[model samples]
Target: MRVLVTGGAGFIGSAVVRHLVNDKRFDVLSIDKLTYAGTLTSMVSVNDNPLYRFENADVCDKTAITQAMSDFRPDRIMHLAAESHVDRSITGAKDFVETNVLGTFNMLECARAYWQSLDSRAKETFRFLHISTDEVYGSLGKEGLFTESTPYDPSSPYSATKAASDHLAKAWERTYGLPVVISNCSNNYGPFHFPEKLIPLMIINAMEGKSLPVYGSGSNIRDWLFVEDHAKALDLIAERGRVGETYNVGGRNEQRNIDVVNRICTLMDEFRPEHGPHSRLIKCVEDRPGHDARYAIDATKLEQELCWKAVENFDTGIEKTVKWYLENEWWWSPLRQRYKGERLGLLPSGA
Candidate 1:
């Protein structure tokens, strides 16, 4: 089968593309705008594969998207393109709205037009899988987990834009009978991850003996999923998920922000022992604006319906992630140079 994967050069997107190209034996046409977070090196493992093709284009461009749809003639379209950094979104929301909301609208329209032109058999098999985030559910209380039915109360500009896109996806399915499925996943960390995010930032920072910044008291909680496991879940959902249904994917591993950093420090100390304790570098910093207290996903729907579960829990996943960064400096060094582990998402003084 052929798959057209947007943002295939990104962290999670590249993982999905790599899995499809290497393990699933599917032809992949990757369309990406190559933004700061999107790097071609993420797909270096499968760069030479004959079945994997790359296209440098923006999803917001209707003409480019339509042409890509016509040229690839894919059976499935996995949409993973967007400005995904929450801190970046806080500082600059226009890019997030333009890319996440308007860009998704353009993709939906292009996919709908293409689906309409296909034969009955091809149309029946076509799927549009929108990959999203659990952040759209907003901050969760310490007691409950976020389910597919959870009401959206997005706390950040990033999650708000994603929420808007999720609405658009479901609305198109209802109004135009588009074959679309949505998956809201938790925080993903593994190989090829940009250094701007928490895990990578901390890892790189600790390695360099730089101060590891922890926001506030570092009590915020988040469910962490390995990128490869998330890729497997995405593939399964795209092929078998019910149209118009939303599935939540998670690691089933919830961790407090400070605890996570401590774990990373412990692991780094074990793997690469330094003169002083790695934890000593931990520094409490100002928290981001509108920071969610906690986020946890109830992925039962994805597990029961699609027979998909995250294979790597927090312990195994974080170890592997740390090792990947330690071993592959070539992959992350450039990113570190570009983005030195810094804090983001500060609320304006008066606003």
Candidate 2:
């Protein structure tokens, strides 16, 4: 299969690209804008593969995206590009709306045009998969998991835009007859993760003996998924999932923010005994604006429909993630220089 993957240099995107090229041996065109969160270093494993080609383009550029669609003649399009950091979105919602909302529109229009141009058999085989997050469902009441039928009640600027994009994808399918499938995933932590996120931030800070910052008493809960597992789920959804269907992919590993921090500390203590008792570095800080109390996804639909299961639970996933950072200093060291774990999403003094 020939696949065109957007944002294929970012965290989850790179994982998907690597799996497509190395595991499935699919002909892949990896397109990315190389934003702050996107680094080419993540795709080094398969960069030289003949089946893996890279395109440095933005989804918001309709002309460029359309040109790529025409040139690549992709049988499948996995749309993963967006401004995805919640903290960054809080500080800069315009970029989120522009990229997530407007960019998705461009992708849908381009996909519709391309889908319309294909032969009957090619059209039947075409799939446009839009990858999204579970944060669109807003905070759960500590009782229920976010199912495919859950109403979207986004709490952050980031998630609100993603929710908008999700609706757009469905609308394109319903109104334009574009073959679109969406997947809403939970918190993802694994190798090549940008350090600004929770797990990586804690691990990097603890290694440096810097203060490990936790937000709002660190009681907030998130269902964590391994990125590699999420990559596989995306591939399965793109290849075999039903059109116009929404799938929730999760690791079923629910962990409190504080517990997650402590677990990283325990693992660090094993790897870097000199940084013994990293838990002592934990420092509770101000909560983010409109912080969701909890987020968990029900992957029943995906598991039953696609026969997919997350291979890594919280403990195993966390260990693998921590060890990756400990061993691969070359990958993360440069990122640490650029982003030093400073607090983001805070309003200026009295804004």
Error of 2 at 55 (Å): 0.9
Kindly list the per-residue Cα lDDT of model 1 for residues 63-156, writing each as its tens digit.
Answer: 9999999988999999999999888887789999999999999999999999999999999889999999999988877799999999999988
User: Residue-wise lDDT of candidate 2 within 215-281, one digit each (tens)?
Assistant: 8788888998999999999999998999999999998888888998899999999999986989999
For residue 121, model 1's alpha carbon misses the true position, in angstroms, by: 1.1
TM-scores for every candidate against the unseen true structure: 0.97, 0.97
lDDT of 1: 0.89
**In model 2, what are the clashing residue pairs, if there are any?**
none
Candidate 1: lDDT of 228?
95
